[model samples]
Target: MPINILMPALSPTMEKGNLAKWLKKEGDKVKSGDVIAEIETDKATMEVEAADEGTLAKIIVPEGTQDVPVNDVIAVLAADGEDVKAAGAGAGKAEAPKPPASSFETPAARAPQDEGSAGGKTEAPTKPTTNPAPRPEEGAPAPVSKGEATHNGARVFASPLARRMAKDAGIDIARVTGTGPHGRVIARDVEQAKSGGGLRSPAAAPAAGPAIAPAMSDQQIRALYPEGSYEVVPHDGMRRTIAQRLTQSTQTIPHFYLTIDCNLDRLLAAREDINAAAPKDKDGKPAYKLSVNDFIIKAMAIALQRVPDANVSWTEGGMLKHKHSDIGVAVAMPGGLITPIIRSAETASLSSISAQMKDFAARARARKLKPEEYQGGTTAVSNLGMFGIKDFTAVINPPHATILAVGTGEQRPIVKDGKIEIATMMSVTLSCDHRAVDGALGAELIGAFKTLIENPVMMMV
Candidate 1:
């Protein structure tokens, strides 16, 4: 027996997806974990995986086809010598996938064609097969042929409702003419006829109505254009995902910003002292290089312990505080930002945090991280200090109550004991959700972080 491969819902909001590309061609062997295709959902381009070990038998929807709804069979996989018929023979021959509401570019505007006649009379007949498909109702309005007229001497191809409506409204259908289905009268035509006080003959209507200049002929446009072509490109999968997520976050989250400045001279000196005594690599780099980020991570751990409320998420029922601090560090990637978590950061040592950050950052940049690595953190940090950003606020990554953005440290004059002196100062801004965290709580949390940074020794102990 063959296994049917239905389109998977890549995102929560995704209903249908475009078959962007097939990773496994027909007859190719596939394992459960292997990526079989790249599916384009409203959010992103996700890799579709096989559910079982088998050979790719047939692809129902070819690449580039859009509107493949979720859970609809898109392909088939089977073991060698398996019968394809066992997996529904009519799989690929189902009705064409309906495009989105936006894809209905043209209005319902073509003239109806003549119905098939049997023995000199038109008759509706039932279609029979193993499928037992339903048939259209008999004795329905006859499909009008081209150049025919209705009973009132109007074009026979006019829609029945339009003709009857015209009669009820005392408007002439023939004079009104039509802009639908092979020039047949439509509802709009009847409405226009009623509004205009009967149908105006094409020649007489324009003459009596509002004056308008004729449209430029295609030949004239061709003459004006020396040479230029227009092309439309579809939105890539990654772009689609970014757009949807950002929109959702902005629309629903109630975000609030809080800023704090930290003196970093002590932090820098401490990093140097820690790195000097650490092991060295073969290439001469410190084995456990204690960077400013490492100190910040350690300081954050202590701050979280002090202000445990900050290490929590907002929920419908109540404020859900976590016993452990799981921090997600946002890493910039080619497509967008992806944060990898440092689970139980409150308990991890500075050296361990440094190692975990390095590993997760490397994997995140390489796009080799698992789904769990990028999900479920109590709080998140995004640092742009390396890029020389002075100060900035970050968006809250829900269901987390707050996110911290760190900026670069620069030498600045500060008053110490009534004397102005040059000191290294760094700025950080915390964006919080007002629903989950209050202004006073956020300020207090920042104060604790300030203490950890100003007194670096306290964090280590």
Candidate 2:
């Protein structure tokens, strides 16, 4: 049999991906585990490997193809001793592999079952059908009914997995309609039936409303402006993802802002001393030079620890309290920005944080970071100080209850003990998720941060 090479799912949420490049060409003898191609997901580019040993018969979906759906055959393999030309001609005809068993299991799989009482009316548990049914071809219409009624009685024709799920959900499998090939009930049907038992087909289920309003088409918007007045630059994948995520964040999250001004004289003085006494490397360069942002990251991490209640994430189920502060620092790249996290920032030394951040920023601009490197964080820091921005509020990234916006430090006069004094003061704004951090709690967290930032020595403790 000719083996089909389906597009692999690089990430859980990935439905489609770009076939970036092909490492192997047609007619190449490929073995199991051979690197065959590169796939570009929305977040990262990953290498895909071959799972079967065979001669590369054909490439159905060539490299550079965009948005190839998962489970779609991208290539074909001529099995050993099989005719290569025959396999190439029959490419894309192989059946897709079954989905993982866990995807079929619903929440009700672990629910308590109601056993019959001593009323002597024990109902037999429904058993799943052992024979596997053929799957429907792509674009094939779904069957009208799930099962057929024989002369003896009505019989439920469902896969073993689907029947098990229906039984776990306490739903009558006979009542659930099937959309699989030849009117067979499948796992998806049973899973969808849990909410309202067999009331409607999956196709008939109500569609969810869009989270954000649709944008105007390019042609529609361009008609408003004069011709040649402006150039239309199309948005790349990175920019599109950034715009969508940021828009979702601002619209969905109820953000509350709190600003505080801190004296940075001590922090600057400490940074200079620390840099001057830093160790040298083999190249005669300083081993590490800490930046003010590093201090801010440390201060924020410690502050979250001090005011633990403020370090949380809001979910529909409940609040997620983090044990350590994984602080994501916004690094500006060519097209946009990415937040690479410093895991357990509260425990890392200033030098270590600075070094890690330097590496992250370099890799981030090159778009070489893995998804996990920039995905989750307890909180985030967005510093526009380098751009000469004084004070600004940042949008709250989802799953992070707060984001600290740092401003540039400049010499300013302050009244101290009824006298005037000049000090280096920096302004900061903390954006909090209203649901996770209340007003008083946010204030306390920012106050703790200001205390540590103004008194740089306290961070060492």
Candidate 3:
């Protein structure tokens, strides 16, 4: 059999992906776990590994192809001692699964891809999730219950029979634990779920309330503007994904914001002294230079530790309290922004965080970051200090219950002992998922952050 090389889902939030480049050309020998291609997800470019070994018999999807849906075959492989030409010929004639009309974000994606076409044939996985994950490309019907997780409010991926069974059982399919590929609920899993081990409380489902109304119709909105005055710049994959994810976030997660002003006198001085003492390289450049944002990252990480209750993700089932602080730092790029995370940030030194951030920023701008670097984090930090924005609330990217928005530091007058005095202050807004973190808990978290930030030396300990 000619083995199909399907587009793998790199993250839980990625639905479509760009087939950035084919690292291995057709007719090349392939080995298991070989990094055969690079797929560009919404936020990062990932090198995909081959799960099986064979000769690369055909390339069904070419490089730079965009918006390929998940599980669409991009290439085929010839088995050991099999005829390569026969494999290629057979695979080329095979039609990939057509994506649903709802999946098409543009006319370009809706159109079928010709060989060498820039449009992708298969996309990756993510939310903004409309359906259950496609089966693995290996063609195996996996039977294990691997605790497959669903994310970003994606619709449960269940077989038609499974859906029918659940419907007959009067069970909410969303509450059943999927045990198939990427946690897709299969027929057998559904059968086992009937015993109640797989069922979740009705509370686990989305809260019943008035739904968010749709915006004005496109035709209506266009009527208000002169036709030629506006040029239609089609949204690329990144922009579309951003719109969807943001919509999902706001609609699914109830957000509440808490703002506080921190005195930056000590932090500014500490930063200056740290940079001055930094060892210089042969190029005479400082080995490490700390930013106020660096201190903020450290403070936020420590704050999460101090007020652990605030660091949690809300699922209808329960709260997920993470042990380590994975802090995602938002970096703006061409089409959209990517939040690259610093894992275990609470334990890392200030200089380490600065260096990691610099590397993440460089890679992020190029869209060269791996999916793991940007996918899931417990919390996030968005600093517009360099942009000179005073303060703003950031959208809470789920999986992350809190996001701290940092503003520029400026000189402001404050009263001390009933007298006015000049002080350097920076304002920060913490956006919390109210379902997970209550007002008091959020206050405590931000309060701890203020203490560490105002007294910079506390972060050293």
TM-scores for all candidates?
0.63, 0.73, 0.77
Prediction 3 TM-score vs. true = 0.77
Ten-residue stretch with the least lDDT total in model 3 = 111-120
Clashing pairs in 2: 146-178
Model 3 misplaced stretches (Cα beyond 4 Å): 13-15, 32-34, 52-54, 92-174, 177-218
The order by descending lDDT is 3, 2, 1
- Each candidate: RMSD: 17.8, 12.8, 9.4
The lDDT for every candidate, in the order shown, is 0.67, 0.75, 0.76
The CA lDDT at 346 in model 3 is 92
Stretches of candidate 1 off by over 4 Å are: 9-23, 31-49, 61-69, 84-251, 281-285
Off by over 4 Å in 2: 79-81, 93-211
- For candidate 3, give the lDDT of residue 337: 94
What is the Cα-based lDDT of residue 66 in candidate 1? 78
Question: For residues 11-90, what per-residue lDDT tens digits would candidate 2 score against the true structure?
Answer: 43344567899999999999999999998765567888999999999988878876666668899999999999999998
Judge candidate 3 against the unseen true structure and give its global Cα lDDT, from 0 to 1. 0.76
* Residue 379 displacement in candidate 3 (angstroms): 1.4
Using TM-score as the measure, the top candidate is 3
Candidate 3, residues 1-461: lDDT per residue as tens digits? 88998878575333457789999999899999999999987667789898888899999988977777656789999988899999999985435444334331443233222111123333233334567656666645333333433323544555444566778988767777654332445454566667656565655652232233444445755688777876656556677557645655777678999999999999899999999999999999999999888899999999999989987876544677889889999999999898999999999999999999999999989989886788778999999989989999999986689999999999999999999999999999999998899999999999999999999899888
lDDT of model number 2: 0.75
Candidate 2 has a TM-score of 0.73
- Clash count of each predicted structure: 10, 1, 11
